[model samples]
Target chain A: MTKLNKKEKELVHLLKENARLSSEDLGQMVGLPSSKVQSLIQSWQKDGIILKHTTLFNEEKLESTHDTIRALIEVSIRPEKKTGFDAIARRICKHPNVIDHYLISGNYDFLIIVEGKSLQEISSFVSNTLASIENVRSTGTHFILKKYKENGIALGTEEMENRILVSA
Target chain B: MSPGFSHLIETIPSSGIRRFFDLVASSKDVISLGVGEPDFPTPWPAREEAISSIEQGLTSYTSNSGLIECRRAIAAYIEERFGATYGPEKEIIITNGVSEGVDITLRTLLNPGDEVIVPEPNYVCYAPLIQLAGGKVVAIDTSQTGFLPNKQAIKSAITAKTKAIILCSPNNPTGQVIPKKILKDIADLAENHDFWVIADEIYAELSYDEPFVSFAALEGTFPRTILMNGFSKAFAMTGWRLGYLCAPQEFIARALKIHQYSALCAPIMAQYAAIQALQGMKVVQDMRRSYEMRRNLFVGRLNEMGLDTAMPKGAFYCFPSIQKTGLSSEEFALKLLEKARVAVVPGSVFGLGGEGYVRCCYATHIDLLKEALTRISNFLKKR
Candidate 1:
C-alpha cells in the first residue's frame, strides 16, 4: 500500500472523527480548494481509502424493546480444494445474524461477530445454520458482557455537558 | 441601585475578543472561528468520575491550596511529563482557572508602578490583569520575530522597576512556541536580572512539533519561575474551572493568601475530575492528536488562500496576516462577518503588533471550518 501524504492522512483522521464534515470544510482544513477536496474524496472512495460512512448510535440513549446479544465466534474450518476458507466464510457471512466476519491468522481460520435478539437465538443460529455448513470444523463462542467503546466513541449512559456557544 | 464602580475597573477595556463572541452568539447562521476553547467534550472517564464524586457526596470545599491527593497527582504528572518537581503541599495552589492564577500571582508579586515585560500580540487577559494588579505592562512587539520574543528585545525592555516577565508557550492567538534556546536565554536573563518568570503553560499539552519544555524545569530557573497550567485546553475542561499556580514556596505562600480571600479553592468535584484526568493521559494524547491535524489543515488552508500564516507549533489558533487584503484587521474581520457570516477575532484585540492579522480558531467542527473558509474565500474574491 502506498503511504498517504500528510494532508491525506489528516483528511482521513478528520473524517474518522466526524464524517459529516462537508467538502468545503475538509478543503478549508487541509488547505485545498473545495473542488480539489471533493475530487480527492472521490478518488479516495474509488481507491478504497474510504470504505463506507456509517452512523454511531448511542444505544444506551435509545428507548428500544430488544436487548441484542452479540458474540465473537471463532471458527476453525476445513479448507476446500481451491477456495480454502473463502467459500465457507462467504456462506457463513450470508446469514443475516453475522454482523462482521474477518479472516484471521490465529488458531482459528475466521473470527465472526454475530448478533441476535437473545442468547438462545444466537446459539441456535450457530448450531443450525453455521455449524451445519459442510466446511465448518468447530466453533468457540464468547458473548459480549459490556461495550465500553465503539467506533472511536465511548459508549455510556451519560449525556454530554452542553458547551457554551462561544468561549475564549 | 447606582453604586459607583472602582476607577481601575472603569479604566480597563472590555475584552475585544469577547465582543466578537457576543456578536457570534446573537447571530444566526454564523460559522464562528472565534472561540478559543476546544470543540471536544471533556473525556468520558473524567466526567464520569466527576459525576460519581458528586453522587458520593464529595462536594465539600477542599483545603485552601486544594485536595492533597489532586496536588500529588499534579506533582507526579509534572515530574513525569516535563521533568519538573515541586512539593504538592508548599508549591502548588489550585485556582479557579489560569485566569485567577494569573490574577492572584500578579497581585501577590507586583507593587504599584512595577513594570512587567509582556510580549505581544498575545493573550488578551495578561495585560489587563497586569493593570488590575497595579503593574505597568511593557509590551514588546514580537511581530518581526515570528511572534517569538527574542532575548535581546526582552533584555532591552527590562529596567530596575521590572518585576516579572509573562511568557505563554504554544501561545494563544499566534500559536507559537518559544524556541528552547531562546527560552533558556530568557531564563538566564531572569537569573541575572532577578525577575520572576510567570510562564502560562495552559497549551503545553497541545504542542505539535516538539515536546513542551516547562520553564520551571530549566536549570537555575526553578526558584524564580511561576508556572501556571490547567485542564482547560488539554482535557476540554474549561467550564470545570480548574487550574494551578506553581512557584517557589515563598511565592506560592503569598499567592495562597490572595487566593484564600478571593476564590478560596477550585471546585471539589472538578478537582476529583482533574485527578482522573491525570490518571488518563491517553485521552489528552488523543485530543492533542486531533488538534495537531486541525492545526495543519487550518494553517495550510490560510496560506493557500494568500494569507501568510505561521504554522502553529501548538494551540488551536492560526494567526493569519490580513495585510495583503489592504484592510485593517478590524475592517477585514467585520467585513468577513457581515458579508460571509464567518466569525473570526480581529488580531488587534490581542494588543500591539496584532493590527494586521486575524485569529482563526480551528477547534470547531471541521464542516463549519470548511464553510467559514469558503465564505472567507468568496469575500476575498469580491474584495
Candidate 2:
C-alpha cells in the first residue's frame, strides 16, 4: 500500500466520521477539486483502505425484537511452515456467521467476533466449524453481555443541543 | 424624577434581535442558525480548572486589572499569535467581556459630540454604545464594496471631531477581514488624522483564509489603538463573560478606573479558567477546523440555492444576499421560518447596509446544519 498524504489522511478521517459527505463537500473540506475528491476516494476504495461505507446499528436496542447473540472467539493455531497464520486465518474467518475477524498476538493467534441466533448457536459453531480447521489448536468462546456504545454513538442517552433560541 | 430615564439611555433603541428571538422561541421543530457564540463548551480542562478553583474557595476577585497570571498569559499569547505586545501589569485590564471593554474604552476616550466612524453592517452593539457615550457615529456603508472596508470611504468620513474608528475585522454579520494593505492605508490615515483606533479583535483567532494582523501591531498604530479581545468566541466561553483590554499605559489606566467603578473585575474563577484556556491551543484549532468545514458546506449550498453568499474568510456567519428571492431580508427570514421551520437572522438587525441580506450562523452540529440547509433549499424551491 502507498503512504497516505496529509490531505488523503484528512479525507479518510472525515469519511470515517461521516461516510455520507458529498464529493463537493469533501473537496472544500480537504482543499481539492470535486472531481479529484471522487477519484481519490475511488482509489482508496480500490486500495482496500476503505473496506466499506456501512451503518452501525445497536444490537442491544433490538433485544426485544431480534434474536441475535454476538460472540468473540479466540483461536490458537499452529502456523504453517511457509504461509504462517494467514492461510488458516483466512479459512477460519470466511464463515458466514463471522461478523469480524483479526489475527491477534500473544496466546491467541486469531480473535474473531461472530453473531448467531443464541449462545448455543455461537458455541456450536466455535466447536464444530472453527476447531475442525487444519492448523487450529483450540478455541474459546465468550458471548457479549451488552454494548454501551456502538461506533461512537452512545446507546440509551440522547444527544441534546440546548442553545438559547437566539443570541448576539 | 422616578419615572424618567437618562436622555442618552432613552435615545438608544432596544436590540432589533428581540422580535426574531420571540418568533423563533414560539415555534417548535425549528433548526436555528441565529446565535453568535460558539456551539462548543469551554474546553474540558479549563472547565475542570474553574471547578477546582471554586471548590478550593479561590473565588476572591483579584486586582481590578485581573489576576496577574492571566494578564501575563494573555500578553504572551497576543505577542506570539498576533505580534502585539503590552505590559500585563500596566497595559492590560480584564473586563466583563468585549461588550464591557468597548463601553469602557468609549467612556474613557470619547468627549461629547466626538465623532466615531463605524462601518455599517457591523455588529449591532457598536452604534448604541457610541451613542450612550455621547459620541456621534459617522456610519460608513461598505455594502457596496463586497463588505470590505474601503480606505477612501473612511477617509471621506473623517473629521477633526473623529475620535476613533471601531475596527472589527473578521466581523460579526459579514465575515470580512480587512486586508494588510488596506490596514496599512487605514493606519496611515489614523496617524495623519491624529485620531484613535478602537480595535474590536474578538474574532481575530478565527480567521480562516488569511493570517490576522492586530491593528495595534502596525507601526505607530499602537499609540492610536485600544485593543479589545476576550475568551468568548475563540475560547468557546461566552457565558463566562471574560475578556480583556490592552493598550498604552495611560489608556489602560483610564479604562481601568471606569471598569473599577462599574464592573469591578471579571469573576475570579473565570480569570483562573482563562489562564488554563491559554494552554489549550490544540482544542481551539480543532474547533476552527470544524467551523471551516461547516462554513464551506453552508456557503456552497446557499449559492446553489440561488442565494449569493460570499464565503466568510473568518467568523461563524455568512451574510447571503436574498434580493433574488423577491422579498426583503425580513420578509425572507420570516417566511422561511413559517414555511420551512428553519430560523436565520434578518440582516437588518446588524444595522445599516444589511437590508437585502440574511445572516446565517454555522456554529452548530453538522447534522442539524445539514438538515437546516435542506429545509432552506426546499423552502427556496417552493418560492
Candidate 3:
C-alpha cells in the first residue's frame, strides 16, 4: 500500500479528531474541493483505513442512576494445536458481556474488559462463562474504581470558556 | 457649570459600536461573533515569565522607552520576521498597546490640516485617531477592488496637505492582507508623495495566505514607515497591553515626548512577558495554524450558507456580503442578534465601502463557529 500524502494524513487526523466535520469544512482545511474531500474519505473507508465514525459517551454521565459495572479480566489459556491462541481468544470475545478482549503476553494470555449489571453478575461470568471454555486455565478480574480521563478528554470541566464578547 | 468638551474631541465622529454592543451585552445566551482578539490564552512561557517577574518585585515603571532588553528583543523580532533593522536604543518605544502606538505616532507626525489617507473598510480606530491628531482623513473605498487598496485612487487622494497613510494588513473587519505587489506600489507612492506610512502590523503574525511583508522592509521605505506591532494578537495576551512602535530616530524622538507625558512605558510585567514571548515563535506558529483551520471551517461554512464570503487571506475575520439577504449590514447584524441570538459587527461600522456586509470574527472554537453558522443559516432561511 502507498503512503498517504501529507494533506491526506492531516485530513485523517482531523477526521479522527472530529469525524462529523462536513466535507465542506474538511475541504477548507485541506485545501480541496468538497467532492475531492468526499472521494478521499470514501476511499479511506473502502480500504479499511478508517474503521468507523463513533461517539464516546461517558456512561456515567449518560445514566446517573443506572449502574453498570466494568471489570478487566486477565486469563491464562493453553495454546491449541494449530490455531494457537486465536481460536480461544475469539471464543472469549464472543461472550455477550465482553466489551473488549485482547490476546496479550507477560502474565496472562488474554486481557478482556467485561461489563455487567452487578458484582455478582461479573463474578458469575468470570467463574462460569470464561472458566468453562476448553483451554481456559485460570482467570483474575479487577473492577474499575473510576475514570479520570477518557478519549483524551478530562472529565468534570465545562468545555465552554467565558471570554470578552466583543472588541475592535 | 460644566465646561464644554474640547473641540478636538468633537471633530471625531460618533461611533455606533458602544451603543450596539450595549444591546448585545444586555442580552443573555448570545453567541458573540464580534470579538477582535484571539480566543487563546497567553502562551504559558510568556505568562510564566510575567508571574516570575512579578514575584521578583519588578513592579516599578519602566523608562518611557521601556526596558532596554525588551526593546532589543522587539528589534530582534522585527529583524528576523520582517527583515527590517531598527536601533533598540532610540528607534523603539513600547506603548500601553498598539492603540497607544497609533495615537502617539499620529500626534508625532501630523500638523493642522494634514490629510492622512485611510483605506476602508478598515480598522475602526484609524479615522477618529487621525481626526483627534488634528489631521483630515481622506477615506479611500477599496471594496470595488477586492477590498485591496487601489493605487490610482490613493494617488488621486494625495495632495500638498497629505501627511501620511495608515495601512492595516491583514486588516481588521475584512481579513484582507495587502499583497506584496500592492504594498510595493504604496511604498512607491509614499516615497514620491513624501508621506509617512503608519503600518498597523499588530495582525502581521496572523497573515495566512502568504508570508507577511513589512512595509518598512521595502527599499528606502524604512525612513518613511512607522511600524506598529504588539503581542496582543500573536501571543494571545490582549489584557497585558504591550505594543511597540518602530520608526526613524527623529520620529521616535518626537513620539517619545508624547508617550512620556501621555502614557509613559507599558506595564513592567507585560514588558518582561514580551521579552519571553519573542524568545520563541513556536507558540505563535501553533496559534496561527489553529486560526488557519478555524478560518477554513468558518469561511467554508459561510459560503455554503450562500453568504458569498471571500476567502480571507489573513487575520481572523470573515466579511460576508449581506446584500443577498435584502438587508443592510446593520439590519442583518441587529436582526441576527434578536432572532438568531448571534452577535456580530455590522460592516458599516468600519466606515465607507463597508455598508453591504458584516464582519464575523472566526477566532473562536470550531464548535461555536459551527453553531453560529447554523444559526445564521436558519436566520437566512426565515427571511
Candidate 4:
C-alpha cells in the first residue's frame, strides 16, 4: 500500500545497490538536480525505506584485527517483562558498530551478535554498557574462535568439504 | 498509508522458500542443494562490461523503459530466440527481477475483488502478490496432471470474476513444461473466457529436451498475454536485478505507469550488461548446455534409486516422490539434512499439490550432485 512514486523508486533503487552513494551522486544517477536529490533523501529518511545511512566497513581493515572477538549474546527474560526486555535490547542495538541482532528462542530472550576488537572491549561493554541496563539479568557469550563461514555463504572450500589441513 | 496497514501486510504470506533457507542456514553442517541460484559466477565478460560501464560514467539513469539499446537488443533477442516480436520503445518495461515484474503486473491489473486463477504447486510468489494486489487467488492444483494444468480443470476454475491466470512453465517445484498443444488449449481458453494470461517464462531458455513456447507466440494470443521474464536464471545475473515485461502496447502503457511509480527502472549498469548479454548469444547457449547436464545427471540418478521422479522436461530441478520412505516431504527434507548433511526444499513450500515430494535443485557442481545422490541412497537404506 505504500507505493513509491517514480522519483522515489529511483531513489530506492540507487540506495539498494549502493547505500554509500552521495545524495548529489544519487540525484545525478536518477537524473534529478542535487537539491531535489537532497529533498528526496530527506523524505526517504522520514518514510523509513531509507532506514539509515551507514558504512559497511571492511573488518580486516579495522584496528581490531582479532575476528575471534565476535560473540553471540543471548538474554532471557520473564514472559511478563517481554516488552521491557525488548526496549532494553533495542537500546543496545542502536550502538554504531553493532552488526546484527535478533529475537530468538530456546532459553534466550534476545540474541545479540556483535564484532569487537578484543575480548576486553566485549567484557567492558558487558560490565558497563549492557549490565547497567534495568531488567537485564543474564547473558551468554560465545567467542568465535574460527569462522568457517559468515553470512549466507561458506568462507572457503574447507568449510564446504572436510579437507585435511596441510602444514608446511 | 491507511488503517489497514497491519491488516493488509498480515494477509500476505511470507515466502516459504525464504523461510526454509533461513532455517537451513542456521543449522550446522548442512550441505545446501536448496538454493535456486546457479552456483556458477556471473560470466567474466558480463561482469567486466558492467564494471566498465560504471567506470565510464554510464551509471546515470536511463529512461524508465530502460536503456534504448538494451530494449532493442531484448526485442531482437526475443524475436530470434522465441519468435516473439514487440516494439522496444513502447512495449517493454525493465524491472528489478522477474519477482518485481510479477508484483507490478498483478498490482496494476487487479482491481479489488478480482480473481487470479493460479496453477499449483508452482512458484511461491503468485498467490501472495495477487492477494496483496487486493485480488483473490483461486489456486488450481496441478499435481494430478504431473504439474501441467489440465484443460478441463482450468475451465472449471474460471468464473465471471476471474480476471487472469498466471502460468509458469518449466514450473518451480515439478519442472513440468506445458507442451505446444496444451499451451494452445490454454491460450484458446483465455481467448474464449476473456481473461488475461500472465505468462512467466523465466526459465524459457533453460528448457532441456523440449522446446519452450511463449504464450504470446501462439497465434491470436498476443493481444491478451503479458510476457514476464528476467536474465537471472539464463544469464547468471541474479544479483543484478535486471528483468522486463513485454506486453501489448496498451497494457505496457498502463504497466509502465505502475513501474514508473514502483521501481522507476532497473539498475543502469545492469541494463548495460544486458545489452552485452544479448549480443553474446554464445553465453546463453553455454549456460543452457551446462544446466541441462546438471538436470539430466540429478534426475537420472534419482530414477535409478527408485525415488520415482516424473521426467523433468525443463528447469534445473527434480521433484521426486518420497512417499515410499513413509515421511511427509518436510519430514523427509529435515531427516536428509540432519542425517545425510544435504539440504533440499520440501515440495509443500511450493503450495498444495507438492505435499509428498521434495524439490532438489541441481544447478550446482557435478561432484556435489554425485555426493548428494550418494547421501540420498544411504538415507534410503537406513529406512
Highest-DockQ candidate: 2
Per-residue lDDT tens digits for candidate 2, residues B158-229, read 988999999898899998888888889889999999899888999999999878988888988888889999
DockQ of candidate 1 relative to the true structure: 0.28
Chain A (alone) TM-scores for all candidate structures: 0.84, 0.86, 0.85, 0.55
Candidate 3 chain B: 10-residue stretch with minimal lDDT: B10-19
Better of 1 and 2 by DockQ: 2
lDDT of 1 by residue, B1-383 (tens): 88788999998998787777777778888887877788878888999999999999999999999999999999999999988899998999999999999999999999999999999999989999999999999999999999999988999999999999999998988999997898899988998999999999999999988898888788888888999999999998998989998889999989989899898889999999999988888878878877776776677777888889999899998899999999999999888888999888898988889999999888876556667777888888898
Off by over 4 Å in 3: A35-160
Please give the C-alpha DockQ score of model 3. Answer: 0.38
True contacts kept of each: 0.38, 0.58, 0.55, 0.00
Interface RMSD (C-alpha) of each candidate?
3.8, 1.8, 2.1, 17.4
lDDT of 3 by residue, A1-168 (tens): 849897788788788778888888888877888899999888888998888899877667777634889899999999999999998888888889999988887988889999999999999999989999998999999999887887776676544265667678
**Docking quality level of the chain pair in candidate 4:** incorrect
lDDT digits (tens) for residues A1-168 of candidate 1: 758787788778778878887787677656678798799889988998789998878776766824888999999999999998888888989999999999999798899999999999999998999889997899999999878988656677444334554455
Per-residue lDDT, model 4, residue B289, is 68
In candidate 1, which residue ranges exceed 4 Å CA deviation? A1-90, A96-162
Share of native interface contacts present in candidate 3: 0.55
Per-model DockQ: 0.28, 0.46, 0.38, 0.01
Q: Considering DockQ, where higher is better, how would the candidates rank from best to worst?
A: 2, 3, 1, 4
lDDT string for model 4 (A27-110, tens) is: 543456779878867876788756776654444446756453777777665433546556766788997445677777677778
TM-score of chain A of 1: 0.84
TM-score per model over all chains:
0.82, 0.87, 0.83, 0.69
DockQ of 4: 0.01
**Candidate with the greatest TM-score versus the true structure:** 2
